[model samples]
Target: MTARHAGYIVTLAEDIREDDADHIMTALRMVSGVISVQPVTANLDMAIARQQVHGEVRGKVLQLLKELQ
Candidate 1:
C-alpha cells in the first residue's frame, strides 16, 4: 500500500526526563502511522509519519508530547 508522509517537530515538556523521553519515543514508534522518531534535544523531538491518516497523526503526536506537560 502507498503511504503518505508528514514531518513533526515536537517540543518536549520541560519536566520530562531523558528516560521518559526514551519511553515516549518508543511509544510513538509503536503508533500505526509513525515511520521514525528522532530526539533533537531534551526539549525537542522530530518524527516522521508514514501514513498521514487524514492529517490526524501529526496532531496526535503533538498532543501526546504536550500532554507530558
Candidate 2:
C-alpha cells in the first residue's frame, strides 16, 4: 500500500494540569513523524500535537495519550 502522509492531531482531555500537559507534549514529540507539539492555552488541560504520519497515525496518537494517564 502507498504511504499517505498527513497531519495528526493529539487532543488532551480537559482538567489535566499544566505540568502534566507539558510532560505529555514532551513525550508526544518523541513519536515518529511528529513535526511539532503545541499547547492549547484556550483550554488548560488540552494540547494539540501536529505530526506527519505515513498511512494511519491515529493509533499511535491514542497510545501516546494512554501513556500520559
Candidate 3:
C-alpha cells in the first residue's frame, strides 16, 4: 500500500483552460500548515493532489479549503 500522509484531495474542471495544477499546489503550500504537495493525474485531465502537512496542524488545510467554498 502507498504510505499515508496528512492532506486532502482537490478536483478541478476537466475543460478548465487554466488548469494550473502547480498553482493549486503552490496555494496549498501558502496555507498555514501545508508543508509540501504531490500532483498525481489520471485520464480525462483529472488530477489527484495530496498536500503534505504537519501532524500538529491536523485538518488545517482542509479547513482552509472549506472557507474558500
lDDT of 2 by residue, 1-65 (tens): 99997877665544577776877888889999897987756532322323333224877878899
**Model 2 Cα shift for residue 24 (angstroms):** 0.5
1-69, model 1: which lDDT tens digit per residue?
A: 998658677765444666767788898899887898987643223233323453687799889999998
Candidate No. with top TM-score: 2
Pairs that collide, model 2: none
Q: Give each model's clash number.
A: 0, 0, 0
Candidate 2: residue 68 Cα off by (Å):
39
TM of each candidate vs. truth: 0.42, 0.45, 0.38
Q: Is candidate 2 or candidate 3 better by lDDT?
A: 2
Give the per-residue lDDT digits (tens) of candidate 3, residues 1-69.
Answer: 899868877665443334656677678889987877766546443322222334336688778889999
lDDT, candidate 2, at 51: 30
Give stretches of model 3 more than 4 Å off. 1-5, 15-19, 44-69
For candidate 2, give the lDDT of residue 7: 76
Q: What is the C-alpha RMSD of each candidate to the true structure, in Å?
A: 13.6, 13.6, 14.3
Candidate 1 wrong stretches, greater than 4 Å: 1-5, 42-69
